[model samples]
Target: MTSPILRDPGNSGFVVELEKFSGPLDLLLHLIKEDEVDITDLPIAKIAVQFLSVINELGLNQAADYLEMAARLLRIKAQMLLPRRLGDDEWEDPRAELVRRLLEYQQIRELVEWLGHAADARAERFGRGYEAPPPDAPPAPLQIDLNDLLAAAERVIALMPDPNLHHRVVPRPLDVEGATARILALLAERETFGWRDAVGGGPQATLVDVLSTFIALLELAKRSVLTLSQPEPFGPMVITRGISREAA
Candidate 1:
């Protein structure tokens, strides 16, 4: 199925295969392997950059498809840069989604290739044309066994999340007094904290950080130490001095 697609037209003897790829997911795997890059320690940013040139060669027909996968690579890179730590249970392997898609696509491609080979062999055999069915042939009605159906149901249910196996821990709440002190220290250097900065984490912020920072802001508000405002709805939340710029 290898088609010898040019990996690098700039250099001679640099090629891969079009038949090996159904879309960008398969192509991404080929790209990563072409450079002899480590899958364990993925060079996401570098791979994303190189993927753009490869997609360009593929042309507008697959423009939408390639762009989607490229976005995933960039997002994974961004996720790695920010938020040094995530909750142990909450954190998911960033590469898992892409890898899953690649595996599924590869399986489908292999199956299709096998089916095509079988069809070619059948075409070469004689008496391949369809013949009339025998008269009075009893059509067998498709019957489903209850046990077989139950087995399939169990298989599907197994995929569902099991709460019994998990251990969930609730983070202890922070003291308002302590939160206030931390906020004051954060304000010592800078006059304002950006929306994300004030929250301490991005959208999926830890419950502890969010609640503590919020209580801290409330304590500051009570003392007229700081102000919170947003230009419009859904805009960035800013924290500024309410009255006097006092640390206390």
Candidate 2:
């Protein structure tokens, strides 16, 4: 029978004509069945030669698995040729391992075939097809009364944690007016200084204080009370007395 042509993945241009056998074992099994010989008593010499010939005909680019199987067959053939020692009747057959593998593969293949047929037979048998409800059909009536629903709602509400427990009231640290007085006091002490010096406390400064100081700085900049400058991007903002402050 003509084999199927498979495109080689390594070389897109190369095409491989693969036989019906799925793998090296499948090919070996096919050869054994064709010869009509018992698996336990495998003709190692003839089988090895046939296996090698088939591999060569397939070409040098055959899979590594096939090459390995070829090598195994050759080794078995060599083992079979070794002469038996006199009075050594307890000699183990080299073909024993290969025979076991073939037998197992054959059983699995048969089981798979049986399963395929069973699946086909199952598909032929049918069940009552699904019948969708009519679109105009009225929805089912509620099983619970209004009193039962209210009781369930009350139970759910009781399980919820009290909102008042999470509520927090923090006093404001400083307002914009307080921030402006602090900046003015710092300016009076020094003609020019960084905004951090005006804000005070560095990293220890609270978020409320920082926000209030920033708002005060923007208001001062707007009124021209102080000029804000950063020599480099993201550098510390330099505060210099504006004309309004110098005039004062």
Candidate 3:
């Protein structure tokens, strides 16, 4: 699909081309796909910042729907920052509702695209006849709305197999302790490593493993066992042995 071009408000001569999105939800989905992160496990803080950047760049602040979605992202980001209370093992994720909406929107968008393609193909196969309808023919009744499409999407999704079922069969909790030990072992072999290295096994590593390793890195940094640095926002994190590790 061709991207749309927008004139820069700051500079009269500057023009920017951005991917066309149907709405705020479509924009969010595009950003998520660019990051290549799972919809179920979103990095809310990062995604929120990216979302705001896109809105500001396009001068969409005046658009009420876009502004509303921006506010929603900020709220979710703030909720995720709050520390969990002790003994509260069932803390619901702040991103849950947003994720659900995004999933539903995605399914409906796909269905619509499929339907459009089918209609085009049918049109090609059957030539349009020049017969006019009766003068008193009734207009076609409205058959579908947002609610109907959402319900149909839900039914389709319910019939599909769960993607995470295999993980449920052999559930392994996030192994922070093991992750820490592995990081230490890696440091023993080298002076520095990147986030992917700490996580290990490259693409084979599961999301749970990546998250647990990240937590382990934070713990190590807190104890002065390692130093973590990122050159810029949304950049790769680098790990190096700390002064304490050197002394030890």
Candidate 4:
């Protein structure tokens, strides 16, 4: 589905069907395009007015995420309204910070656009049956033994020894209690969501969360709470909750 947040307001002069605004940067970009103004010397009053108009239209729920930026714009507008102090040769422009932030946003926006372009190119290639270029491999193998691998593994384990030597641990703190709850909630709503989506953009969890979630998910798999399948190695595992029973 297309993100409403990225849609352009119509070309009609008044009473635009405002798409959902994601954040302050989105609002600022909208105002910039609307006014056709340079970022450096943006008319604070005009931009602020446009911003307020959009906010009023957005109402409370949609506006909550954007309040910080709206407040910032107001602060800048306030500074612009105030008279400069006496004997100040170089006055700091109220628009400077806003300009800086907008520039950064623009850079990121360009990056996203570039990535989208690349993705489209990749899609085209796939559509045309493009095979990936072969990976370069070592000219010769540097052979090592099973004992050497085991000894290296032991050394690493010794470096960061777990204090509790003998404990059949119930579960780690980063256990998936909350994540599992969230997963269940999502499944209840969506029926089936991508396993990758279940993880969200992750903040991802720490190693503990990843490990415990994997273990917990494995347990859930055993209990037939969910089904996990890897149709393709190195691809995302497909998960459909409340199906199939197999040891994780």
Best by lDDT: 3
RMSD of every candidate to native, in Å, equals: 31.0, 21.0, 33.6, 23.0
Task: Put down candidate 3 lDDT per residue, 68-169, tens digits, no spaces.
Answer: 898899899899989999889899988999999999999999999999999999878856685876698787775667776777687556645569675443
What pairs collide in candidate 4? none
**TM-score of model 4 vs. true structure:** 0.41
**At residue 139, what lDDT does model 4 achieve?**
75
C-alpha lDDT values of all predictions:
0.68, 0.77, 0.81, 0.68
Q: State residue 69's C-alpha deviation in candidate 1, in Å.
A: 1.8
Per residue, candidate 1 scores C-alpha lDDT tens digits across 1-248 of: 22123233343332343564667867877887799887666777778777766665655224456667767787887886776465668877787776677667767878989999999998888785777886896877646577767775874565455578585465565655666676687788688886567665464555566677888887787878888887643445788866774544
Off by over 4 Å in 2: 1-19, 126-248
lDDT of 2 by residue, 5-118 (tens): 232334433324465667888888989899998888998878877777665556523667777888898788888889999788899888999999999999989998999999
Global CA lDDT computed for model 1: 0.68
The residue ranges of model 1 lying beyond 4 angstroms of the native Cα positions read 1-21, 36-41, 86-89, 128-248
Model 4 lDDT per residue over 47-109, tens place: 876776666555521444465676777788888888988889889887888799899988888
What is the Cα-based TM-score of model 3? 0.45
